[model samples]
Target: MTIPALEQIHRHASVRHYTPEPVSDDLLERIVRAAQAASTSSNLQSWSVVAVRNEATRQHLAELCGGQRHVAAAPLFLAFCADRARLDRACQLAGLSQDASTLESFLVSALDAVIAAQNAALAAESLGLGICYIGGIRNRPLEVIDLLKLPAKVFPIVGMTIGWPARPLRQRPRLPLHSVLHHETYHPIRDEDLLAYDQTMRATGIYKDPEKGWLARSAQRVQNPERPHLAEAIRQQGFALK
Candidate 1:
């Protein structure tokens, strides 16, 4: 027998199409409590979520997120943020300043936000809702920060689109178990693994064929400095990359 949460995780899919129903405040609070339950580093939970329900704001955010229609269409759009503002406040209360300028500080806060978002997503899924993560918010980081009115020590890390699914859920194949799940020692991924997964993806008929497969596409994303302004934007958000 499958555990309830495990079953939910296994059936996870990014939902794009959504019905026109709004998520109730009660449901939102429940999912937020689930997010709070996520473990944080050193008990310093440096993350916050901004829930967007306003129409005009959601429209502007959708544009900022590279015109992802689901962001605008979803009943709720949640922006998960890497936030050290609370820590800064805590330090201020103790008459001390937060030295949260290191790269590690940014990493910890980003990871915390991501983990919390995953918990909230799972909770919403268990409650018969759908979700899609939007990494495109990084495309125009400065604009997003301005529009969201985030404090100096805060930055949007990810956005989640939530609503009831209007269409069938499409579950894409993940990398092979052995390719990702290594043994005691770190193992290098073999070329065959990529090819096999590429072949499996082609069978799905979801993604249009590119000139190259997964590895090539992955490399292209890395090679492209499309979000060149992101690092500077993060620095402007008070994370000193020095």
Candidate 2:
């Protein structure tokens, strides 16, 4: 109760279901402005945000995102993109070659887009809104590109669903700081420590089955080498991350 930011930081949860109330244009502007204020590499600011309020577009996006109804149901949806098309065009107009389409450049733009989206999510939470990130956006990236009419050199990094929280919910637990952080030197990972952390996670009751621990679930997810078709999408979108 003492630290004001604690409520904003510690209580962050991904809200899947939402009410029918719509987000206002003024509120959306404030969130976007907050996102724009985030730092960018070399001030390139190679990022763009697409606010999808159209029901038709949202329906298509929902289908593209593995049929997650929230994509269309949320009061507002945002597609954060790593954009180099406009920048490349600008450089060309200035009689300069676009060396900015390199792998490093692409990474920087992607990072900028993620940072901006997170900023916007935090700002929305501060305004008493709830949000959930949609990594499923990348599952059918080419479909997203076609649906949104994104040009070459622009990639949809991620999508976000924003709306009022339906009701109060328990916060999701995170791994302990010691497990993830280090001091002066990196500490060796101990099998016992990892098992203990897994036990703690299982005890948190957030997992559907309390018997299933983090290690088993994570290993299963990684064991399948075949992820969603991203390479083809990326290639079709004109990003040769080769």
Candidate 3:
């Protein structure tokens, strides 16, 4: 049976255009509270969010985020960061040795940030606000870190833009259920499944050229090798990744 929450989840679409109206601080707090309610690893809650409302900062961030104008146009932009600095401080206060510099530490913090961001996104959507995740921020991690004044053990995981939608948005198509949901032991992806999904994507007309389907687009994206310096950047930010 379809519930209201399920309906909302299924209706989700990335909103690139937004109205000029600003999101009230009271409402933004509530949305963030909802995000804090998301499950965290070992209750560590190793994540932080920076709310960017300043016009100039947003404009600079938009430029850093691969020139996405929607980022600057949005009423609010949130930078979700994977943070272990707080935990390290806590450990030091207790006179204990802290070593949150490993790869596992980075992974856990990133996962926590991602989960919290999704919670915030859903909450915003429920309140009739539009939201878009900005992974493009990773393209210039060092710049973002400097702009935000992030600490040694904290790094940007992703960014989000939120505001009231200027117009209706069409839901994007997803991969077939069989391809994602595997039963028993891991099932190998069938070629037919990919071909069928590619055809479905072409039919949906999300792409301008129907000939350029999911497979081609996804392959092109991976082959482009964007953000090659990301790993080195993270290491410089104090993540051992070992």
- lDDT, candidate 3, equals 0.93
Candidate 3 stretches with Cα past 4 Å from truth are 1-3
TM-score of each: 0.94, 0.92, 0.96
Model 3 TM-score relative to the real fold: 0.96
Those runs of model 2 whose alpha carbons end farther than 4 Å from true positions after fitting are 1-3, 226-228
Q: Scored by CA lDDT, what does every candidate get?
A: 0.91, 0.87, 0.93
Arranged by lDDT, best first:
3, 1, 2
Give the clashing pairs for model 1: none
lDDT of 2 by residue, 104-223 (tens): 877888999999999999888888889999988898888899889899988999999999888785676677778678999998777887888889888878799876798898888788
Error of 2 at 118 (Å): 0.9
Distance (Å) between predicted and true CA of 92, model 2?
2.4
Query: 207, model 2: CA deviation in Å?
Result: 2.2
Per-residue lDDT tens digits for candidate 1, residues 24-116, read 999999999999999998879999999999999999999999998989999899999999999998999999999988999999999999999
Q: Give the per-residue Cα lDDT of candidate 1 at 198.
A: 82
